[model samples]
Structures are given as structure tokens and as C-alpha cells.
Target: MISALAHGYGEEAINIFNNMVRSSMKPYRITLVVVLNACSHSGLVQEGVRYFESMTRDHGIVRNQEHYACLIDLMGRAGCFDRLIKQLEKMPCELDGRLWNAILGVCRIHGNIELGRKAAEQLMELEPQSSAAYVLLSSIYAALVFKKKKKKKYICCSWKVGMGREGETTYGGDWRDR
Candidate 1:
């Protein structure tokens, strides 16, 4: 199943999962993560939702943060932002960096500046020392600038400014503010 997913064969991975179920082999938590990830990467939104919805009922495996992340990623990659937002609101688990990161990624892909900024802010609060969120936010801003054919200059820089590991620095502002 992992090999199939790594090779971009999501259908094959799903087939393997079905075979495992038919053979009476109960899947582990990580197994569901991989399957959901496969569904996300392969654009199998319906299948992914089915598997996620059935995780606890059919397989007795409770959904966790990783599962929610995969489902969010799946929905976001499909440009189902409305549905994704609804799902996020109802998520049983607490929102974390992983979930926000998934949302940010989809926002970036869809050029949703509002939601992207929210996601980025949540990520920054959850993982302030990490530069990934800042970088992604800048990318979204860059996309917006290019889309509008704006001539204003934009600047983004992230680095550590002090001896403490927690002293991460990031500088960014909207070109429109210039």
C-alpha cells in the first residue's frame, strides 16, 4: 500500500486496503493516515470522505489529528473550501499546527487570501519558531500581487535574531500599505 501511494497509484493503494479488509486484517491508525493521504494526493475526495467517515463505525479506529489533517488536505486540494470550512468547525479534535498547515496549503493553492491569513496566523501561534508558516503566507501575498498586476514592491524576511531558540523574527507587510 505504501509503495502504491509512493508511486502515485492511489487506486492501487485503495485496492490493497480493500484486500486487507477482505482478508480480515484490521488496519492500524497509521494505516488510515496513509490511505487518506493517498486519497488526497490522487484527488479521490469522495473515497477519502467515505473512508474517514467509516473509520470508527466500521473499523473501530477512532479518528485523530492526523486523520483530520488528511481529510482537510483532501477537501482543500479539491477546492471545496465551503465544505472544508464546515468540516473544520465540526472537527472533534483540537486544531493544531498540522491542521492549520493543511488549510494554509489549500488556501495557497486556491488563492484564498482571507482564509490563508487566518490559517497562517493560527500556525504562527501554534509554532512560532517555525518559518514554514511565514514563508507560505508570503507566497500567498506574492500570488495576490501578481494576480493584480501590482507594481508595488513586497518584502519578506524570516530569521532568528537572538541567542534564544525561541527568538524567531519575521517581517512582512502588504504592498498596498506601501
Candidate 2:
């Protein structure tokens, strides 16, 4: 049910969940995680928050980092960066680099450069050698540079990685045009 919701079948998943509950089936931690994730993906902030609260109040499931991460992602996607940051700060357990990375990614999407930089700094401090951190920082710089250029055009960077002896994959415009 949760996976279905995450994949954009919230109504069907809710029906399934309701049926399960009616049948007296108890939800486990994984079930909660999936449902929360689905709510996040669907941008159902209020529903997500209600389920998150119920996780503890009704189900007695202690919120873990994964659960918090899902909630943060949901809030971020809904443009509630302030609330997301507050939730992050109040997290009871120490957060891993992935959580910070998710926040940074959302900040970048929303053009919140300052917060993105702070999140990147925190991520670097937590995992200095993370390739993803460097990539994200570089992307932020590139975005800033593009804003300065104001070229009224979009640029895409593409590359391929593979090991093959007999074949090759070619991209871009027709070879004859070259």
C-alpha cells in the first residue's frame, strides 16, 4: 500500500490501508515508513504530518532518522523550508550525511543559496570525501554563474560511461550535420 502511494496511487493505497485496518491487521514500522514516504511524494503535507504524529501517539512507533528524512523531504517539496529546518534541528538522533544532502538538494532547487551553502558545509564536515557534496557545490556555483550570464538559454551537460569493445553509442545531432 505504501509503495503504491509513493508511486502515485494514494487513493488506492488509502483504500487498501483502510481495508487492512478494518481487518484488524496492525501496521509495522516499515508500513509506517512507506506510508509516510508516499505522503511526502504526493505532497500531502497535512496528511503526512497527521500520520507522523499517529506513528507515536497511536502506533507507539518511535520516529527514526529515516522517518524524519521522509518528513523533511515532504516539507521541502511543499516549500516549507523553515519547518523542515526546524524539524532537522529538533531531530533526537544524530543525522547522517544523506539527510543533510537531501536538504541541500531541496535548497538548491528552491534557489536558497545561503541555506544550500550551509547544508553543504555541514555535509562536508560530516563526510568530507563525499563526491555528491562536491558535485552539488559545483552545481550551485554553476547556477550562480548562469544567473550572471543571463543568456536566456539552457545548457545541458551529458556524458556516458561504459566498457565495450564491439559497439559505441553516439548522441547529439545527426553525424551528417557534423
Candidate 3:
């Protein structure tokens, strides 16, 4: 199922999941993880939320760190920053360094500098010796610098021909960074 999902076969995996349910085969943690990942990959935000709710409501699978991480990642990727922050606040267990890091990474990607800084500060408070936390903060600074600089950016692509016309080609280095 995971292999299928990884290969972009989300609909097929969903069909298999439904078949498993029809056969009365209970889904375990691993199955939930795979489906959650598929939900993220396919941008099935609503389905991901439903499945997360069902994990505790129907299956009685206690939500753990991994589950929360996946949920946060899905919500963050969907640009549901408010909900993700609220969920983080409501976590019963003290969030591990990894969870904070994931949130910080998303914040950085979305250019939410304030939120990223807050997450970084929280991470530092939680794990003072974590090199990852430092790196994430540094990345936020680097992104800000790049945004301010507005340097020219170029993309290069190379093509190779193995047929009768043996040749090399390059294209697309014209776009200016802004």
C-alpha cells in the first residue's frame, strides 16, 4: 500500500483500504501512517482530517507523537496555519524536538517569519543542544536575506541525445529572481 502511494497511486491505495475494511480487517498503526502519508501526497486535506479524527474516535488508536507529527505536517502543507498552531497548543504530551522542528520548517517555507521564530525559540527552550534547531533558525535568516537581496536567479537544464543526432542542449536560464 505504501509502495503504491509512494508511486502516486493514491486512488488504488484507497480502494485497497476500503476493501480491507469491507473484509473486517482492522487497520493498525502502520496502515494509518501510510494512508496519512497518501493523504498528504494527494493533498486530500478533508480526508486526512476525517481519518485523523477516526483514529481516536472509531479505532481507539491513541494518538501518539508520530500521529500528531503527521497531522501537523498535513495541516501545515495545506496552509492551515491557525489550526496547526491550535493543535500544537492542545497536545497533551510535551512535544518532542522533532515536532517543533517540523512546524518550524513549514513556517519557514511559507514565509511566516514570526511564527518560525516562535517555534525556534520554543525548540531552543526544549532542547538547548539541538543542532537541528540552530540550523532551522539559520535557514530562516538565510531565506530572509535572499528575499531582501533580490539577486538574479538562473535555472539550467541539460539535454542529451542518444539517437542518430548526437547532441547536447541547454535551456531556461533567463528568469530573473525577484
Best by lDDT: 1
User: What is the per-residue lDDT of model 2 for residues 1-178, given as tens digits with 9 covering 90 to 100?
Assistant: 4575666876566567667767988888888778877777777889888888888887788988788777877788788988987888788888788788888877776767888888888999999878777788777777676667663333334565657434435444311211
TM-score of every model versus the real structure = 0.81, 0.75, 0.79
Candidate that beats the other on lDDT, 1 or 3, i.e. the better one: 1
Q: In model 3, which regions exceed 4 Å deviation?
A: 3-7, 151-154, 160-178
Clashing pairs in 2: none
CA lDDT, every prediction?
0.88, 0.76, 0.78
lDDT ranking, high to low:
1, 3, 2
lDDT per residue as tens, model 1, 4-49:
5634899989999989999999999999999998899899999999
Q: Ten consecutive residues with minimal summed lDDT in candidate 3?
A: 2-11
Off by over 4 Å in 1: 3-7, 150-178
Name the lDDT value of residue 73 in candidate 2: 75
TM-score of 3: 0.79
Cα-based lDDT at residue 124, candidate 1: 97
Model 3 RMSD in Å is 3.4
Count clashing pairs, candidate 1. Answer: 0
